[model samples]
Target: MNSLADPRVADLLARLHDEADAQRRLIRDRVASLADEAPGPEAWPHHMKDFYLPVSREQGRFLYQTVRATGARQVVEFGSSFGVSTIYLAAGLRDNGHGVVTGSEVVGEKAETARTNLAAAGLDGHVEIRTGDARTTLADPGGLVDLLLLDGGPGLYLDILQLLMPRLRVGAVVIADNITDSGAEPHPYARWVRDPDNGFVSNSITLKGGTEYSVWIGLP
Candidate 1:
């Protein structure tokens, strides 16, 4: 909500700010200490999508860590921006010995850049970058997705849900980022999934902007 001035919102923001700052320092230190050939040039590239609001590398790492903690083997992402998150996810997958990430990007350029970045990160083989509307691409994804990330257009959030609902495997974790409306109630996706019929246990966390985390409960 735009009522970021509210004490609750302010407190949440402060916590996020502190956490983000700590994460940035950690990422910097990790990157700095890495051997020149450790990550390698093929580990992650520089070209990002135009709309890519790069997440704090730490946030990316955290997401990856969460996925790894869940022991997720297959992941799907609604938006692939510059492959920053892709790199993080791929790193976790690599560490897990066997995993894969499939990301969708509507913009061709963004998809291309994502591919390059994944290749740079030595993750191209572990990640698949799809160029098209995510809703459609996910409609018939070949495998059960264990984890999902939503960072595409806000208005399309519900559409993505409808498309992915039937495909989501039980126990899957869905993370939706950027769910704010400045004084408005929760976003449409949050509202819709809150309905009992949707079969999702949902909660909002005020992370960077706002993040809605949901898990499927009912059988598809």
Candidate 2:
């Protein structure tokens, strides 16, 4: 189940990354056009329809390694845009011998596309694509979650995390994407997780975009 080496997984990931790369210019233009607008999630749907928002190739590999290293049996992903990141997470779980990655996507079309991509990579068995706002779709993950990934709307990151906070296993890792350059959306989430009183040890990792990497120390 070492999917990293599996030709199908490799092929699918490569193609998806290329698709993202091709949209880089469009994304840049869109950002420039909205330079005067306060950055937030309200405009996310428009962007999603215009282009693909995905983790960079390196970041994707990092996600796979992160999940595998943690020995996570259950993973909760706050976003599954086209399933690019989902593939990486599911691959990690498959390599772990047994695990599941449950992903939440608010966009119905993106959720459908994501499922198709995961199936194409032969990793569908390890992923569940729940279509709806993560806060509601992930109300309960069945049991303790060993890892959480937040790559959806920044404005909702804190809310999503709060919804899943009680379900986190001690030492569980939370990885949030697009944390920087999105104005103040991530500030609340960063503050909450970075505060020792909140029971999380958190720091930012600089990827293509910033990612807040936090570890849950659990309730004292």
Candidate 3:
């Protein structure tokens, strides 16, 4: 009963991966210029509105599998972009027979589009896309989160994680994307998660963009 293998979910994911691949070149060029011009996340949603800087297909599958394996009922996603990852998370929840994916995206347009895509995949009922700063929109997830995905701005990873710390149940899993390139020094988020004092035990996983897979062990 793999929901990802369902025609609706699989077809949508295929289309999304293709779309992301097509935007690689444009995203590379736009990001280079945006880095010099705007230089921060404030302008990203607007400038990169047309781009899909989304998670890789492999990452999406990992997220889905994590939800299923953990029997997660509440999932939080920081930076859903156009909802590519949201669909994966939602599908997992749907197949779990219950659960929901709370997604935050600063761009209203992208959020709307993401909702549309989820609807197309028949997973909208399992997802709620909030359009605003994740720091605020996800302030209260209403219940303990079983899994968290940090796929938004690299700079805000730690901040968002800390903010949601109180609501993450023990043994909760947190996955942060784009932490570092292969062989590069760990990103700040990685450093923080890998510190035992912070209540997590984490290590990097080789994904398209470096991924930090961590588990909550409670404060030392």
List per-prediction Cα lDDT, in the order shown. 0.70, 0.86, 0.91
Least accurate stretch of 10 residues (summed lDDT) in model 2?
A: 42-51
* Alpha-carbon runs more than 4 Å astray in model 2: 31-43, 181-186
Judging by TM-score against the true structure, name the best candidate.
3
What is the C-alpha lDDT profile of model 1 across 158-215, one tens digit per residue?
Answer: 8887787777888788888787646767677788776667888888876767778888
Report the alpha-carbon TM-score of model 2 versus the true structure: 0.90
What are the per-residue Cα lDDT tens digits for candidate 3 across 1-220?
A: 7889999999989998898899888888997888779755687678988888889999999999999999999999999888999998998898899999999999898899999999999999999999999999999988999999998888899889999999999999999999883355667778889989999999989887589999998999
Candidate 1 lDDT trough over 10 residues, lowest sum: 41-50
Candidates sorted by TM-score, descending order? Answer: 3, 2, 1
Clashing pairs in 2: none
Misplaced by over 4 Å in model 1 are 1-49, 181-184
Report the C-alpha displacement of residue 55, candidate 1, in angstroms: 2.7
